[model samples]
Target: MNFFKIKTSWSNAEFILIKLCMASAYILVGSYFHDFFAEYYSILIGIFIITAIWFVYQWLKKMKTHSDLPY
Candidate 1:
């Protein structure tokens, strides 16, 4: 049984903004509350970089597929 429904009309800008806000909030809160970053800094950085690259790749691919530029 499906417990929740998702809306897929979100734009790329909203996705990026939310991701940035959440990551910054997590880092800020974690630093203030404990040593979360001190222990997993590398892992977090790697994931952030990889995800950014993946997002750019997907965005570009989608744009190219839907381009309407005139020759």
Candidate 2:
């Protein structure tokens, strides 16, 4: 029932890579069905954009935390 729970921790880069892969899959599918489902295709593109933004945010946050650590 706890769908959001992740079984194992992932590094920021790994997590972002996973999200990007999902987004790419969505884009491919959307493009394939563009003629039949323009609205849904737009939705897929929106999701991809959101995912990309999230990846950037996470990557930046990770870098900030690393910079704050004592070397």
Candidate 3:
């Protein structure tokens, strides 16, 4: 399913909680599956790190969002 297909009715608090949960899940899953992608894991991790940093910057710097926080 696509990200847009997910239903998130909660406000900012819920949004933050969801993000934290997703990040934690990523870390846990990656650690457990490290052996499966020993070489490709670095690329995956770099992309994840870049995406996460971009997300953080957008969230922290954005004062007024025309759409929702997730968008």
Candidate 4:
């Protein structure tokens, strides 16, 4: 009976929307940069994007495991 007592707010939805918007903006910017840079150094922009993503993943992993805070 208690299973239906859950409460939720729009905070999570808002957060997701904001993240989506940010990701869309990032995609546009990345594409522009990729086009601009690929003309001069082919594949350099892609490599840069991959490296940045890798570092962000590593940082997130470290923070998740090294902190006492709850996820």
**All candidates' TM-scores?**
0.52, 0.48, 0.41, 0.38
How does residue 58 of candidate 4 score in lDDT? 100
lDDT of 2 by residue, 1-71 (tens): 78678588778988898899999999999789878886577787899999999999999999999999998
User: Which segments of candidate 2 are over 4 A away from where they belong?
Assistant: 1-39
Model 4 C-alpha lDDT per residue in residues 1-71, reported as the tens digit of each score: 58789787777767998899999999999888975765766467678899999999999999888896765
Which pairs in model 3 have colliding backbones? none
Q: For model 1, what is the C-alpha lDDT against the true structure? A: 0.86
Clash count of each predicted structure? 0, 0, 0, 0
Weakest lDDT window of 10 consecutive positions for candidate 3: 62-71
Candidate closest to the true structure, highest lDDT: 2
Error of 4 at 20 (Å): 35
| Model 1 Cα RMSD, 1 decimal | 5.4
lDDT of each: 0.86, 0.90, 0.86, 0.84
Q: Write the per-residue lDDT of candidate 3 for residues 1-71, one digit (tens) a residue.
A: 69888986777876898899999999999899988989897798899999999999898677556455675
Candidate 3 regions with alpha-carbon error over 4 angstroms: 1-11, 42-71
What is the model-wide C-alpha lDDT for candidate 2? 0.90
Candidate 1 lDDT, 1-71, residue by residue in tens: 56567546888887998899999998889879676458777888999999999999999998997796666
